[model samples]
Target chain A: MSGLILDFEKPIYELERQIDEMRNFAVTENIGALNEEIQRLEKKLARLRENIYADLTRWQRVQIARHPDRPHTLDYIAGMMTDFVELHGDRAFGDDKAMVAGMAKLDGMPVMVIGHQKGSDTKENLMRNFGMAGPEGYRKALRIVKLAEKFEMPVLAFIDTPGAYPGAGAEERGQADAIARVIYEMGRLTVPIIVTVIGEGGSGGALGIGVGDRVLMMENAWYTTITPEACSTILWKDQEKAAARKTDCAEALRLTAADLLELGVIDGIVEEPLGGAHHDFSAANQALKTAISESFAEITSTPIDTLILERIDKFSNMGVYDVVPADPV
Target chain B: MSWFKKPNSGPKKGDGDRRNIPEGLWIKCDKCDAILFKEDLDRGFRVCSKCGFHFKIGHQKYLSILLDEGSFEERETELRTTDPLQFKEKQNYPDHIKNYQKRSGLTEAVITGKGAIDGRLVSVAIHDPSFIAGSMGSVVGEKIARAIRRSIELRCPLIIISTAGGARMQEGILSLMQMAKTAIWLTRLSEAKLPYISLLTNPTMAGVMASYASLGDFTLAEPGAMIGFTGPRVIEQTIRATLPEGFQTAEFFYERGFVDQVIPRPELKETISRILSYFPDQSMSPESAEEGV
Candidate 1:
């Protein structure tokens, strides 16, 4: 499972595999020349890694974002925070396993941490609904954020869902209504909120719990209203054609973290490790921790009412349009 | 009612049957295959007299139907889309905007303004389904946000008639953020204790439904409107099964406790006026207040 290499990473993996084989051969056979060869190959591997990562296309970054080995929300909390207390249930219906929320401490300061939890394997994926939350999942998130507000704790939310689940049960239970209320409530919550997109920030599902005073995205994460595959399908109006044209759709959508930053949709981009966050978990956690700490400190210093109004203002000024003259009314 | 009622024996509703009806004088009900005079359909507010299905109407028609005569003074008419994402598929996003504007005779999907309902001053925004299925892009979102601000300024109740497929994906994430933008402004309205009434017309689904449309203080829906997060076809594709009859309809939402009331078109004006009467009219002039009473 650790050996899974994406199409773009194949060249780098091949060099890595060759270096490992040469090291083992030199150790067993006591060949001195093979050691020099191994050193040369290691240097080549470093350059290759840098080159590939430096110029990754949006689609390649998307693959890296969804990489199974990439750290999940729980992994970040465990890696960065101290004492953790896991909360559960929306208090209205059955608990949603897809959304995980709890009270936790960050650098000795109390904070509420919430995120969409995707599984590491097939069995766990089904259990987590592939992190596509249902209505109860959002309601659970809403319940905890309110708790965070009452206690006057800052919120750190990690977005990793593909979207709110589109299914019979979700719609029957008022999925849209649930998601809407979350956005509406988050708009006015008293505490400072800092949202970080660690993985796929899917559409309304991501935005359901995404409104914050400081919205940040991981370097490789992609946040868009819809997935490229779905975009292609609707644009081309044919399944097979859509399959072939999704890369173009991804390019056109401009969903990368850097793209969003340039478009002024996010406050900043949290840098990932060299080969992406999946390559070095500790480094990724440290970077995310530093970014969150800075953002939290800045917003917490401001008065609650000013912060809330500014939060609303931040979202209000997101789009670009012209105010042309109109026909007389 | 029997367990199995026989299917109605009538001309099946399809493309061929629709073409058979004369264009100007006669029209066909989409739900039931009842052929009727166009004049009668207009008189009934474009609802099927037999099956009670609400046919999609333009924003101007809604403004006329719901507001007092000549009282609707449109606002935010200057807001226009600029294709911020530079999106293109078979055609460019700007081209699509131009085409729809020409065909629908409107600048955007939603039209916002201040108007009077039963002589009580109120802010109003209505969606035109003819323009891109009333998909909300940046322009639509900003206009709605400004409309909410206008209500706060005027100290009047706000009414929005929504008929949208969802957020406009052509503008990408910018369109998605509009959901948050409008919803956030609505919180200001809520803080002021002003009333917000959202009416869902036919085919209000996805992003628009999940935002301001669902956040209304009082939510009402046209009869038989398709109202949900996901469309029936998409749900069927995901679950790999047939949907039960009347799934995701306005009536279905009402039964599921999502919608406050399922109103028919003809009674819309009277019902809305009655609902508005329940709230205190703070800015009503003496003459208008007497008329309101």
Candidate 2:
């Protein structure tokens, strides 16, 4: 398997597939010319892949956000943080695996790390509920954040959910109330809060724990209000017509990290590897660790009350727009 | 990610057997197919007398029904949406705003005001669903946030009635940002020990349902209202399956424990007034709160 290749990566993968066959033949037949050609083909394949991923459109960035090999919450913790102790349950309800929270040390700095966990494969995804957190997941995160606040520790939240689960039990359990409570709590919490949109940051599911002193996004990640497919159906309607207009829907959603930064919704975008964070897990982790420390330093220096008031102001001031006096013809 | 035990999922509740009356200025109850007269329905606050299918009511009716006589003084009528998006598709957002303004005669989707409910001062925000489906745009969120802040300043209870499809997509991401903006105020209200009563009406879904509307200290809803994050139409298309009957109704939520009480329209004012009396300052003076823990 090529590890969940996108439509745009077909040409590069085709070359890589051919190069693999040629390399095997060269090894068996002991041909120098064949090995030389294989190396050249591999170089060409790498360049092609880099070029395609460089200036991707909104839809392409969305695809990268869901790449199967993308490092998830557990992967990041393993690579960077130490002394991680997993926490479980919301106390009011059973444990929800979609959102995982625990105490961890970042370079020996004690902090609470909370994140949405999407599984690497089908079974794991099933267990993690594809990172579409239910009410309990949000409540569990809230509990950990509250605990961190009691001890005056910083909070580092990683958002990567598709959206809140819209199932029978989730609704019954007050999914919306749970999400609203998390955002409400994070805004007024006395301790420093830092949030990174590591993957798909879909709707309120992402915003449930998204408020922070400084909100961040990965270079290849997206933070759209609604998914492109959902937007397409809502704005353009169903069937052949909607499929044609989905790219337009993606553009309209303003979901890209660059777009969010321009809109003043996000503070900064962390640079990812050439293809994406999925291409180099350890390096991606390093970048994330450095970014969090830098943000935390800037945020924690402020007084607690000002930090809380400013955090609320930052979110409240996001959506003010002036009505144009006249329509642009 | 179906992370739930199956909730109360049977046919529509409270829409039990009904008697048919002869039709004149007649409207058919969509839930129970009972022929209802327009005049009789109005007398019952637009609920079908026979089956209890609550017809949608706008902000005007809500202010009158819930508030003490002529007590509501609408706040922030001057706050208008800048149409910051200058968003256009089938029609420009400004043009759409003008049409809705003329049609609804309101500054925003929700009407925020301070009024006496059973002689107790409370901040109220009632949404008009007919105005662009009562989608929460920037102004809608701003007014609600300010209203809650006003309640905090006044040190009184707050009531918000919500009925919406979701965030206004025309405003783009800014519309979605309104959800967090409004919820920020709810936390402030909670911190200050102010009570918030969220009243969900018919068709409360999407961003509106996910924000302050769902976080009320004493959450309540009208009978047969659909209250959820995603609407059934979207879920049906996504999952490609027919939903069980009574999917997102208030009765369903009451069974699932999302809603505290499912009151009919006539009993709403009495229930809200009763809940308002429970607040510490409502029964006692502000000086009394300062005197004790």
Clashing pairs in 2: none
- The digit string of per-residue lDDT tens for model 1 on A1-329 reads 45468998899988998999999999899898898899899999999999999999988988888898888999999999989999989999878889999988998999998899998888888999999999999999999999999999988899998889999999999999999999999999999999999999999999998999999999999999998888898899988999898888998899999999988999888999987898888999999999998898787779999999899889999998998776532
lDDT of 2 by residue, B16-95 (tens): 11121212356667678776676677566877778877877777778878998877776666666765544554467788
Fnat of each prediction, in sequence:
0.85, 0.42
For the record, the alpha-carbon RMSD of candidate 2 to the native fold, in angstroms, is 7.4
Candidate 1 wrong stretches, greater than 4 Å: A326-329, B1-24, B282-293
Q: Candidate 1: lDDT over CA atoms?
A: 0.87
Best by lDDT: 1
Highest TM-score: give the candidate number.
1
Candidate 2 C-alpha error for residue B116, in Å: 2.5
Cα deviation of B238 in candidate 2 (Å)?
Answer: 6.6
Measured over all alpha carbons after superposition, the RMSD of each candidate to the real structure, in angstroms, is 5.1, 7.4
Q: Which residues of candidate 2, in runs, are more than 4 Å off?
A: A15-50, A323-329, B1-24, B82-99, B234-243, B280-293
Cα TM-score of candidate 2: 0.87
